[model samples]
Target: MRIAVFTTCLADALYPAVARATVTLLERLGHQAVVPADQTCCGQMHLNTGYWARGLPVVRHHVETFEAALDSCDAVVAPSGSCVGSVRHQHAMVAARYDDDALAERATAVAGRTYELSELLVDVLGVTDVGAWFGHPVTYYPTCHSLRMLRVGDKPVRLLRAVQDIDLIELPGADSCCGFGGTFALKNEATSSAMLTDKVAAVTSTGAQVCSAGDSSCLMHIGGGLSRLRTGIGTLHLAQILASTREHPCPVPEPRRPARRRPSLPGAAR
Candidate 1:
């Protein structure tokens, strides 16, 4: 199958490795992966922030970019469940809100072809194990969008379980949101922090050195909190974990370092 990768904004900016891993996994499975340079954010941030008007252009651009790529690719795939969920669920809503029937129909058609990485691998490609191997204690946290919005249950875990020598641990409160609902964290910092505290505690209790999730946003929040506490646990995208192989094992990521505190001025108190 010829697959086109929809590298979301978060992955493009903060987690390019995850996007690369998605492509690597697809190619390793004997499928071609195409990444169109014209592809940009799916406007999920705008839509989630209630700026449907502002998001329509972004949604339309995405549809146009992929529609063109469809000439060479059989399907569109994204490592992010959140972005896929937006394209599948929110794009059409934006069109309908504005009563753009033509755009709505087009949006629906494009959404139908878009798939989360695990969905494509298991349902479309008909393969569980992609000959991957990652020998370490790891746990998975199902992101909110992937779980509730996309309804991609067990598919990611099923793929992880098939990895050779993988010691997959069950994460306590695996379905709980990691307190990173995009702008929600910024809007409700205190509440977000409290929720993150619980998530980090649950992750630590599993005694897993690494935590994996489908969405980079959640992983960034969870991983950042863990890093601040100096927990020594790392966060990885499912794509990176799945791309690991016996010949080329996924290297354990270095613990994230906390930002350095700036020095006080000469007259200021220490």
Candidate 2:
């Protein structure tokens, strides 16, 4: 299958490894991964922040970029479920909001073919085991958009379980939000931190060496919290884990940052 890789903004700028892994895993499955050079952000940030008029051009550009590329590619795939969620759910809505029925129609066509990493892997590729081997205890956290919005239930787990020699530990409260709703962390720091605290505690309790999730954004938030609390847990994207193989294993991650005291809970012993 010929697939276009939609390297979302966060994956493009902050977590390029996740993007690379997405391509690697696909190619290993014998799929051609084409990354269109002109492709840019899907205007998720603008639409997500309620900037409809401002988001239109960005959405239009994405629709134009991928709709054209889709001419040669069988499907579009991204590592981040958040971005895919935006592509699948927001692009058309934003276009329709501005009364651009034509753009909305185009956006829907592009989105109809776009899939998140797990969605592409399990649903489209029609395979769970992609010949991966990772001999470590890892827990998978299902990102919110992928879980609630995309409803990509058990696909990620099914893939991880197929990894050779993997100890797939179950994450407590795995479906809870990591509180990194893009700008939500910055806008609501206290609430976000509290939610992250809960998530970090749950991850640490899993006794897994690494915390893995489908979205890098959530992993960043969870990783930061785990680092501060010195849980010694490293965060890895799902693609990275799936990309790992016995002969060419994933690189050893850098040591986690030093620990800090956990935030004091109300009426709780510190």
Candidate 3:
């Protein structure tokens, strides 16, 4: 099958290896995966922040960019549930506001074709393992959108269970939010930090070497807290784990900076 990979903005800038792993997994399955360089942010941040007017053109650009590829590809797959949710749920609202019926229709059509990574792997591709092998134990955090909004449950866990030498641990409160709701982190700074504190605690409590999820944004928030505390808990995306094999091991990223300070509690700064 032919597929187009939409590496979300955070994945592109902060977790490029996640994108590389996505491509690796797709090719390992013997499918054609194209990385469209013209692909940009899905305008989710602007739309979610209520900057509707600013998000219009960005939405249009995405619809146009993916429309061409969707016409010929089997599916448009992304590593982010939030981005997939934006394309599925928000694009039409932006189009309808401007009375761009054609664009709205196009947006809907493309949204229907878009799939989150887990969705594509389990539902469309119909395989769990892709023959990956990771020696370390991994604990997965189901990002809020993928777990609640997208309802992508267990697909990731199922894949993880199938990997060789991957001691998968059930994260305590694995379904809880990681507190990185785009602008929510900035707008309600206190609340966001509070939620991240709990998330990091849960991840550390697992004693798992790595904490992974479908969304890079949430991982960044969770990872930032873990790093600040010098907790030694590493963060990775789901794609990176699925892309790992004995020959091609996924390395834990080097921390960019020490956490500014320790988190005292959920939403509390120490």
Report RMSD (Å) for each prediction in the order shown: 4.7, 5.1, 5.9
> For each candidate, what is the lDDT?
0.92, 0.91, 0.89
Q: What is the TM-score of each candidate against the true structure?
A: 0.94, 0.94, 0.92
TM-score of 2: 0.94
Residue pairs clashing in model 1 are none
lDDT of 2 by residue, 1-270 (tens): 999999988888899998899889998999999999998888888888888888889999999999989999999998988889999899998888889999989989999999999898889889999999999999999999999999999999999999999999999988888899989999999999999999999998998999999888899998899887777889899999899999999974664755576889899975
Write the number of the candidate with greater lDDT, choosing between 1 and 2: 1
Better of 1 and 3 by lDDT: 1
Q: Give the TM-score of candidate 3.
A: 0.92
Per-residue C-alpha lDDT of model 3 across residues 170-254, encoded as one tens digit per residue: 9998877778898999989999988888888898899888988898888888888988888877888998988888998888666
Clashing pairs in 3: 194-266, 194-267, 228-259
- Root-mean-square deviation of Cα positions for candidate 2 versus the true structure, in angstroms: 5.1
What candidate 1 gets wrong by more than 4 Å, as runs, is 256-270
